[model samples]
Target: MTAVHVTPTEGVDQPTVLPASRRDVVLSYIALTKPRIIELLLLTTVPVMFLAAQDVPPLWLVVATVVGGTLSAGSANALNCVVDADIDQLMRRTSRRPLPRHQVSTNGALYFGLALGVVSTVWLWTLVNPLSAMLALAANVFYVIGYTMILKRRTTQNIVWGGAAGCFPALIGWTAVTNELAWAPVVLFMVVFFWTPPHFWALAMRYREDYAAASVPMLPSVASSDEVSRQIVIYSWVMVATSLLLWPYTGWFYPAMAITLGIIFLIEAYDLRSRARDTEDLSIIKPMRLFHFSNAYLALLFVAAAIDPFVK
Candidate 1:
């Protein structure tokens, strides 16, 4: 394959050309937004609106929730990239991202993130409900300011607390439907809270060197794999317990799905933890699989809740 090279200006020795196969500047920009993570968060949000309200929320409401939440999440991820770009440039996984690759300027990222954030908040407020709008704003702040900026470098537990930023979608979507906060959504929030660490740390395990090089202090870089694996198991068990709590609140069908999925997650966690006696890279491969599956598990459980009204 021929490389597309970007030549630097007069003062710079070499110019950098971004990946050439991609077109659609908009798509590149969107890719910078980390759409998969946003989609997972949104997946948690939308179905809960239906579950909490016992039917599909208004079509306008759902559309508003999706568009607005996505924008907010996109903005948050973009800003995170901007803030961490220096460190990101050192990581093999993230080095190719727009910011790290020098394909997008910091100023451009900042302006785009803020523009998208404002538009998202406005759309949610105008079309969905004020509470969801507020929630979106909070999620953005929690991530960009609270988690990424402040806590990430300070503690190995960064993801543990930082993950809270991602949980607001459940509350936002629920309030969009019910117009008030309630315990059921709170339960869902707790579920995600417990789920984040093991999921993220599993990936971090593969990239510990990158994190160490970046001085990011993520769990895998900061803690022993044994410790991380232990935490994974503990959190996985707690996550399962949390899922069981939703039985009375969300509905029976959701509880069943939750229990079933939770058990599967626990087994995966156990496998990850048990294999940590030795650092055989191959042993923990399944943990990554679990991390990916956990995202789907959470989404499917929420979808079950959404459909529970008819069955009940």
Candidate 2:
């Protein structure tokens, strides 16, 4: 096969070449799924499986659950790219995505998403359990219909409730282990639920004008910086408080880590709030500081949750 070559178009920052080989095509489709986002979802997942088992789960079960969960999230994100392609083109942050770059057509992305969704559902049902399969499907539906289709363009609070879709991994992880739901996983679910708003809002704060230009009403785009900051602080407190609820079940280590992480999280939130209150220049706000930290915060917290049972 001859290699396809791409060069930059005059005045364009990105290369204009299409995929030249089967490998490039496969990777382009995978890129449509937004694998980084899937990693975070899996971060919340694997920890809960360990916590649910109260020990390490079987190696095969862990591998199966992670694979199924990745496919499910990939489906949802690919569909999201399809649905959001229009606004995605308008936002500098997302303008180079496969759909906007024409590396993947809308129809192709849609079909890929649906196929992954179906495959993941069947994989979970056969290898894990029917309940876990259904929950994965429900998360996909909720994200596609509830968040992307219904709420994204319509509301300022889109991410707050839309984020419920991302919380399903904790439940899916727990069920994959115990084959049933329990209160501990529910607490983990809420931890991700409350964590979503502040985490997302910080990024939205940095990209407020991009969202404004795209005409999507993310909270940061529609509200005052002070208002957005206040809400971030509020949600930070709530997320920290919710993390504490696992203490009775998880014991000292989880709570100790929670309190320690929560303090740093609160400090960042408050620092962002202070900057918002004092500065008129949005560039000075440094919202990405909190955004990056939130990612680390959640990853570390959940890892601690997974390790808590072994210590006790």
Candidate 3:
């Protein structure tokens, strides 16, 4: 990632700068939002809208929701960078973020985050509905406050509960189309909720030292390999079980896909656990295998959900 040289502003006594291009500055701000994470969140969003509408929803609404959701989630992630900037500099994995690298100023990022939040709220309220807007806003608050501010450094179970913030996209998509909540989206919500710990713990396992160095209490950072694997297995099973709850709501294709993906996810989880049990070497215990697989599992499962409505 390239960084831009910044001159000292009126408020800042000393400003840091990195040599970067114009495109780099734009990309740096984009990175602040954690765009890849937003992709996963939006994946859960559009499909639930499909399941909620029982067909293809309005394209304009889809576009609007996507834009609004993007802004809302981006705001949360950028603010998270602001809040975690101190420890972010300590963690190798996060040391290159705009804030830590000085690609974007602290005050600039803070203002950017707040501006995105306000715009997202009003955009959703006007174009989508108040319910969807409120849900998106609530997710932002939970992520920025509950997850980043309060729970993250304080508890080992941080992602376990903080993960709930990620689940709201399911509800937001459903309400975007139907303007109401329903059981189908609720089931999807629980799937993501349960899926969070195992999914995130896998990444944490891979970056254990970085997390430990930063003093963040991510489960894998604080717990023994056995304990972390145990929790991963537990959460994996719960996620798979919650996925099956969609059986009644979705058609045959969805259940079939769900069952198959669930098995794959479980297999990956079991493999991680098996490797951890058999080996003491952290290098041999490749948790990222599960991490990458979990990403595919979610993308495929949600895409299947969207496709199932048409086939069924």
Candidate 4:
């Protein structure tokens, strides 16, 4: 006898029959971890470690922290996939995920996520420090329970506050080095917090229909293009300002790069707002330009921070 499963198809609940293949099973398990997201998170983490050291950090500590952070972030992302499987099936953007495609069982994914979470804590505690471990655990819990379970469905402000979970890498990186937190990491944390809305909202604008189909009240899906663009500009300003706050701790080189990169980010953000004011058509709006630039802006800015310590 063949197996049958029911999954959401483009907002309609329907039955799908898919046989899980061996290679697909392996890939599907990795998909639950969301490797691209982990890459971005590590981009923030390692650079902060460099700045925290103000010199070369120990090779062993950096490797350990990266490994531990990977496990922790992977756990959060996997659990998120489990919780959002229903909505994931509904939206075309997430329709091909392992859960929606029946490539992985929910219970299996759930246990995998849990086990990763426990291992991350122990790995960080034993190799990094207790504070770093605790920070990772808190971020894991907040992302799963606070953001995915509570805010994602209930409000349009979901990613704004929920993005705090991503900000933990700065704290974790700093603590992994010095075994304590400071204003420098806090400033970097605020930069990420403020940056999340504009970054996510731009992508959300491109996928507004998918979000609407899923009944997820993302700002872009529920709000007008003008309103969303306006908010993006607002957050972009705050994000750039918060980024500058790190200059005092860094050096002249960091501020110079921050100011230059920030100007480019603002230019792109305002351009999006201007285009949005003229037309609601996504084709003309081209929000993804800003979306892609934002990613580079962040990566470059953090890279500058990491390099400043050496050049200063």
Ranking under lDDT, best-scoring first? 4, 2, 3, 1
TM-score, prediction 3 = 0.93
lDDT, candidate 4, residue 262? 92
For residues 1-312, what per-residue lDDT tens digits would candidate 2 score against the true structure? 111223322333443458888898999999988999999999999999998888889999999999999999999999998888777767778778887777877789899999999999999999999999999999999999899999999999899999999999999999999889989989999999999999999999888877887789999988888899999999999999999999888868899999999999999999999999966467788899999999999999999999988885
Give the Å shift of residue 237 in candidate 2: 0.7
1 or 2, greater by lDDT: 2
Residue 117's lDDT within candidate 2 is 99
Ranking by TM-score: 4, 2, 3, 1
Better of 1 and 3 by lDDT: 3
Clashing pairs in 3: none
RMSD of 2: 4.5
Instruction: Name the best candidate (by TM-score).
Output: 4
Best by lDDT: 4
Residue pairs of candidate 4 with colliding backbone atoms: none
Off by over 4 Å in 3: 1-21
The true-versus-predicted C-alpha distance at residue 109 of model 2, in Å, is 0.7
